[model samples]
Structure formats: structure tokens, C-alpha cells
Target: MTKRQKRMAAVLLLLAGLSVAAVLGFTAFSKNMMYFQTPSDIAGGKLPEGARIRLGGLVEKGSVQRGEGLVVNFSVADCDANLPVRYEGILPDLFREGQGVVAMGHMDGKTFVADEVLAKHDENYMPPELAEKLTTPDGKHSCAQFKSMGGST
Candidate 1:
């Protein structure tokens, strides 16, 4: 082949290889990705069934229950809607009712089966993701509530 033709072939091969590498890299990274969502966002079936996601909201008052082993069940609410969560294993020290929290896991029917649970520490701390979702201008869960709790909006 002519030198110019050979060089063109090499360039095309390199571009193809790079494209494949990028696709594979993106696929691998996406497998570990977990999107954040609130109870209201998923209430209308906006979320894909059984997809991994970060469920964030306030722990509903009086919804906590301790079952066998390290299993604990509770509900997360954005004041307008609530998402039930079941978690197994030790919980964080700050976990409690009437508190903002984020759980990592997938949904099973109407319940979220969480493999990990995170609680906001300190009296003034709130997960930024959860805070943003709850900070609706006219919603019951407003930024004012965060301010009232001594948390920065």
C-alpha cells in the first residue's frame, strides 16, 4: 500500500480502538453508578424498576422498627410522599426518626431494600442531595425547615 494509504489505515484503526475503549469504560463506570431520588420522584414510576439509586428523605416519625438480626425497617418521606426502606447491618450513630437520611439500594415492590444507610451527623448537618430534593419553594418540605434546624441551605 502507498505510504499515505498505510498512514490513513493506522489512524482509522487507532480511532476505532479509542472508541471501543471509551464505550467499555463508560459501561463499566455506569454499572457502579447509583442515581439519587426522592420519594416523590419515584412515586409516579419515573424510576426504573429495581435500578440502584440513592433514596433520600426524612425518616418518618414513628416508622422505625427493629426486627431479627441487624434488620431495621423505616420509611423515608419528603412530606408529600413516603418510601419504605429495609436495611440490614449496623446503622450509623446519627440514624433516628424525624431525621434526614440517604439509603443506597434498589426497590422491591413498594419498599426500598437498602444495603447501606447514611445519616446526617451533627444537629446542623444535612445531606446536600437530600436537602436539595426537599427544598421546594411551596412544598411542605422547604428550605426554611433546614434553616430552622440550624442547617445551611
Candidate 2:
């Protein structure tokens, strides 16, 4: 091949390799990235369908339901708003209604299909995000208004 043709072919090959690398990099980043949001944020239509995200809130009272051996359905709420969540597989021992939880999953319309569930280690330990959201402006949890179901007060 002529010198010009050889140089042009080399440039095209480099561009093609760079494009492949970019596509692979983006795919890897998307697979690992996660965004956290409160139930209110999700209720306001701020959720995307494909990205894995965290929904942090209190498990709503009277919203836990068991359908099959390992399938459970519940709702996450931030006092003012609620988002339904569906999770399969064994749940944590600390999982229960009225406790703080953060679910990682994607939104399917109004429901969050969680692949993983995280609960507080004990009643004295609550997720910081949930604590901030559940407390009043005075820096205290309003016992009469928003008491912990079982999570830390």
C-alpha cells in the first residue's frame, strides 16, 4: 500500500479502537453506578427506569405482605409519600414494618423492584438519611407524629 493509504488506515483503526473502549467504559460505569433518593423524590417523578437506585424511607405500617415463600411486598414512605417495593429472596432479620430501610433497585412505574434490601442493625442505629427525613425541624423525632416503628428514635 502507498504511504498515504497506510497512514489513513492506521488512523481509522485507532478511532475504531477508541470507540470500542468508550462503549465498554460506559457500560461498566453504568453497571456500577447507583443513585439514592427518598420516597418523596421518587413520588415526584424523579426516577429513571434502567439505573439501579436506592430508595430510603421507613417501611410503611400495614403495608407488608407475603405472597409466596420468598416474595415479599411492602411500601416505603417518607411520612408524606409512599412508594411500593417488591423484593424476592430471603429478607434480613431486621426487616419489618415501621423500620428504616434502603432498597436498591429500579422503578417500574409506581413500584420499585428491589434486588437488595438493607435494614438497620438495631433499634439504636438508623440510616442517617431516614433519620434526617423522619425527624422534625427541631432536631428531634416527633414521638406523637413520627415515632419509630422499631428503628432508633
Each model's C-alpha lDDT? 0.73, 0.71
Kindly list the per-residue Cα lDDT of model 1 for residues 75-118, writing each as its tens digit: 88775678889999998888977767779999899889999998
lDDT of 2 by residue, 68-93 (tens): 88899998876666789999978888
Q: Model 2, stretches more than 4 Å misplaced?
A: 1-35, 121-153
lDDT of 2: 0.71
Reference-based lDDT, residue 142, model 2:
19
Top lDDT prediction, candidate number: 1
TM-score of each: 0.58, 0.56
The Cα error of candidate 1 at residue 93, in Å, is: 0.5
Off by over 4 Å in 1: 1-35, 121-153
